[model samples]
Target: MGHINNKYYLGFEGEPEIIFTVVQKNNEKSEISIWSGYFNNIMQQITPVEGKWTALAYYYNLNIGWYDESPWLVDNIEDAYKQFKSIDKYKLDDLEEEILEEILELFKKSIEENNNVYISYE
Candidate 1:
């Protein structure tokens, strides 16, 4: 099965603050973790997605004079951090809450350092 993957850049090709990840057979970093969700209804609804993502990228492409390549700009990454931080603690299991906290740490570091978080399905 295909899995969603993310990579962060410090505006350079260095190690990123990875929020979600898994390992592969060759000891390489790969994606595919089935235990990613726990059944809190709100958790199911939680994701760091911008609603007008496609439109934003489309306009960005036009501004760059490129019709074929539309890449989402990293300027809006604060929205992603806010989503992760918006989880209601009362509804989550202790483990789920802990996981979210851990993930938020990565977001915090990246944001503070002004890095770019990249998500793709590989």
Candidate 2:
């Protein structure tokens, strides 16, 4: 029998976060765990799959562009802190929540439309 391969999404609310896990069967007796990561943006996670592996992504809506804005665009932790110090506090609070809800709705729609093609790991 072929080894079971599967993918799962951990969170679907609040912020745009995703976890991707790939399991490959190395032999008839065991399986190996492969790549995994969390993406905060929709564009960053969009890519084509290659070889004998498949890809899966799960994300919320609020965090779509949260990290791409200024102050958060620093190269490292120290730079981020320094930039944050000079940023206007109220400017960060103006982000719209409705947009997040719309994005989440779109994600759900895509998943539902593609449900028939997915193989359940559980």
Candidate 3:
């Protein structure tokens, strides 16, 4: 009953996928999950973290992450491809490369800054 939102899946290699939703003010469904090993690894490396990741806007707040809808919101593989093509010129392969680069850098930065990494649904 609201505006439709695009789903963004974020993850590191060899680990399970972690989803971060790109919410449209009025839109939304889907189940969201982060791997336990991934979560624990991050916590251990970051240590005694407080604030943001403290259950505020973090993924732990499941109330905002799920619904009875498709994860990609595409009804079928064919439709998914068509919709993806309509959105941008960049191929999914290109996007994957870019996302990986950025994510790797983010992980490095978190380690360097000793700051908690907060991947929130937005």
lDDT of 1 by residue, 10-91 (tens): 2323322222332233434433111322312324435434643332233332443122322223345566567657767677
Off by over 4 Å in 3: 1-92
Question: Judged by lDDT against the true structure, how good is candidate 2?
Answer: 0.26
Candidate 2 C-alpha lDDT tens digits along 56-98:
2211123322233311211222322222233333332222222
Q: What is each predicted model's overall lDDT from 0 to 1?
A: 0.42, 0.26, 0.33
Comparing 1 and 2 by lDDT, which wins? 1
Candidate number of the best lDDT: 1
Residue 107 displacement (Å), model 1: 0.8
Give the alpha carbon lDDT tens digit for every residue of 23-115 in model 3: 332333223334434433332332123543322223233333322222432122232222222332242245443443443443344345443
Q: Sorted by TM-score, highest first, which candidate order results?
A: 1, 3, 2
RMSD of 2: 18.0
Please give the TM-score that candidate 3 achieves against the real structure.
Answer: 0.27
Write out the backbone clash pairs for model 3: 3-27, 23-122
Compute the lDDT of residue 50 as modeled in candidate 1: 69
